[model samples]
Target: MEAALTGSLLSLSNNLDTQAKAAQKDSQALRNISYGILASDKPSDFRESLDNVKSGLEYTTQYNQQFIDTLKEIEKNENVDLSKEIDKVKAANNRINESLRLVNQLSNALKNGSSGTAEATKLLDQLSKLDSSLSSFRDYVKKDLNSSLVSISQRIMDELNKGQTALSNVQSKLNTIDQVINSGQAILKNGKTRIDRLQTVLPSIEQQYISAVKNAQANFPKVKSDVAKAANFVRNDLPQLEQRLTNATASVNKNLPTLLNGYDQAVGLLNKNQPQAKKALSDLADFAQNKLPDVEKDLKKANKIFKKLDKDDAVDKLIDTLKNDLKKQAGIIANPINKKTVDVFPVKDYGSGMTPFYTALSVWVGALLMVSLLTVDNKHKSLESVLTTRQVFLGKAGFFIMLGMLQALIVSVGDLLILKAGVESPVLFVLITIFCSIIFNSIVYTCVSLLGNPGKAIAIVLLVLQIAGGGGTFPIQTTPQFFQNISPYLPFTYAIDSLRETVGGIVPEILITKLIILTLFGIGFFVVGLILKPVTDPLMKRVSEKVDQSNVTE
Candidate 1:
């Protein structure tokens, strides 16, 4: 069966490629004729184009017929609808014929001395209609019919492939059947051997039958006496007994009606109730046909609802998920992850939580402002002559540190007093702010003292980076990986951490660690400021003098 189906599919798929190419040729011819008709300007050219269009229409009709026949064949063999794809072709053909008639009428009028611009205009209009008809016809042939044939051919090929797979399966099943046949043959051979043994015993069985018959013949005389006795009894005695039994049956038959009179009335009553039973059966049938499906669906829906709220266990799950509040049940379902967030030192509000980052930022900005606006090393020539370089450096650095500490004190105190920020330990918050500010100013001051204005630019750059990379506005890990990696090293990272501890509620060990880190940064930068100044000062002074020549103040 599979092989037969495969052959049929292959035959159907065959010549599909050739049919596709023929369709392409007809489509291209139609388009070419359309273009020629549209381009025609002269009456003679229009006449030639109309003739071409009539020919193309004839060709289209024939081409459509071929495909229709193929589709008819498919519909006959397969469960598919051969759609009315030829309607467009037929319409186009009708339109083309009408256009040809119009063109001929115009041409004959011009030839018979009806020549004028109006006549020419009528000719162009008829040709335009012809071109439009042919263009639509071309698309139907080129795109729709070609694609249809390709898809049909592809379906045939797919069926053929499936048939090939089925054929392999059939062959394997045939092999199994052959094995069964072989087993049956072996069983038949065994049966034949048993039949031969039975034939060998058949003569002895016949001899025993003959002996038994002789033995019976010997008892025939005695048997005849017994039969004669039985016959005598039957002829005389049996008739009298049968007549007695018949007399008894007649007597019973006479009295049976009286005995069964109540039974007869009961049967009549039951027979009268048969219509009600029939009506009930009909109603049951109607219910099965019409109402049972809806009833069954409702039962299934009820079962589903019951499954979710079945018993105590289901109720417990619902209560647990809803936290015993039915109002919050939908909200719980919307966000199912029961995230138990635990903030160790929770602050009062967003402002309170953000106080640390902004506080740290204020002090850093304050330090940057001081260094950018204030002179770090007082380079006055008279003061340089009067005071040693160390005294000048210490005086300026001390002044910057003092103002930076003052900036920290104002910011930290204002956070507690004005903002009423949730500062758990106001004293530690103030202390950490002052200490962080000292470090910030020292770093900026040292950079400017050693590197001149370049150091001031470094301070601004650090501010931008810390504002982003510091675990201040957002956690460091949420920032870019670059920020997260360098966060531990940024001065503002530890500064913000220390201030946060005080604002939210201080963790003594963590607060100490952060403050120690801040102190280390301060001491390190302070040492660099005092030590690197003597070395960088004179060299920067000469570079500064050259820059003074350029008149751009550092």
Candidate 2:
């Protein structure tokens, strides 16, 4: 038992590592593609692109090794399960899906000239071929009676070989694209050098013009100077000299614009040519295949070992183990399942707490407080002297609504005090929080008017519900379908969503909707409460009797 547990733990650990590596590689590949596709703008995004590419590659290799290792382990087992094999196949398919997703992302980045379009496009094509081949091959293997173990092994081997060939061809295509990107980068650098040189000359030309102007002025006769001196300077020396400097400066300025334009045109041409090269790589990768020789060899071995078992039951057990291993691997590709139940705990309203928590609390607290304060006596009411049924019900609703507003003010003030630190959308955030509080107040009041103390129990129920549907942490959609469907009906849910948006830089429309809903709920409850007040006399008497017993006991 201990050994089996150890094996399971080890397997899980490897699976986790594989996933982490795959994620890293996917991110790196994205960065590399960005660099290749957007060669012109690579200087700015180059670091990110490169980092993503390297990380993605590392992760992919790590994940692939783990997968292969797991497969080998399952192959070695004497008793294999068909279900386990199916699971493993599914896991492999999931890995393939991830690869495909990464490829697609890279292709998009390339098409948009992100970083490494050619390489990304090629990788995408290779991934596509691998997916198609695997899909068909897995189906063939599942048919069980397609051929003898040797024949099936041969077929798988051939398919895997095709896949590896595709991988090789894709690598070649990426190399060509890389060359074009490097060449383009070189040309871009040259253009920058030329532009820089021209920029350096500009200030000198301006200075030269200033000097010529000063010399022309100094040559001119002053008010006290002779007429002949002034005339000589003006006609022969100053006019000619001033014109020379002015003409030189103007000529330089005029040529600068044209020179810059030409440089820009050249850079644009290079960028355009780069894309064509990237496309060529993508086309080449499309022609390649994705095959695994190891996989085929392992399959052959497993099948041969299975055939040697004389008893059908022993063969079945072996087959079951194989199938189980395969299925387990496949299941790993999907989102990790959370078997742990939701742990309900007290949520602290730390100023940094998400909008939903505050909004929901505000609404529920306000409604109940307002209603309780308005109708219920501070001291105990007994059989000897009890508040009228009408007073108790309507009064509680009114008091809670008012209390709700006061609570809203307190929270809003708190927000204002810390708004600078974190509250991004002050107006929207406060409004939504207040809106939710009012709605919660209204809903609680309505429930109390109908069921009295039993309604307080209903508030508790709402609290549990809000925790699940509030989208405070777990997104409502990811929960059970019933919660997902019913979430919108709860005012706290909308309020929380709205407040979260406001705080998190997402402006939600639910705040306004909450207000509308709250108003409607308030009106409906008020009307219902008035209608029920006369009929609920008997229930009110019983409540008074309970109140007397409590007071007497105290």
Estimate the TM-score of every prediction: 0.40, 0.32
Q: Each model's C-alpha lDDT?
A: 0.69, 0.57
Q: Give the range where candidate 1 is weakest over 10 consecutive residues by summed lDDT.
A: 197-206
Any runs in candidate 1 off by more than 4 Å, and if so which?
A: 1-343
147-260 per-residue lDDT for model 2 (tens digits): 222332343334334544434444454445435444767757655654443244223333433444454454344322444544565567767778999999999999999999
Off by over 4 Å in 2: 1-353, 362-396, 418-421, 505-511, 546-554
Provide the lowest-lDDT 10-residue window in model 2.
144-153
What lDDT tens digits, residue by residue, belong to model 1 across residues 1-554?
33333333343334332333443344454445444444555434445544554455455445545545545555544345556554654565456455545545655664665543454455456656656666665656566665555555455445444544434443454445435444768757655653443244223333433444454565557556655655666677668878999999998898888768878888888899888989999999999999999999999999888886775478678778678677688876788797899988778899998998999889888888888777776758777679877778788888998999888899988988998998888998898889888888888888888888788888888888889999888877789999998888889988889888887777789988988888888789888878878888889989888999998874
Give candidate 1's TM-score: 0.40
Superposed Cα deviation of residue 90, candidate 1 (Å): 99
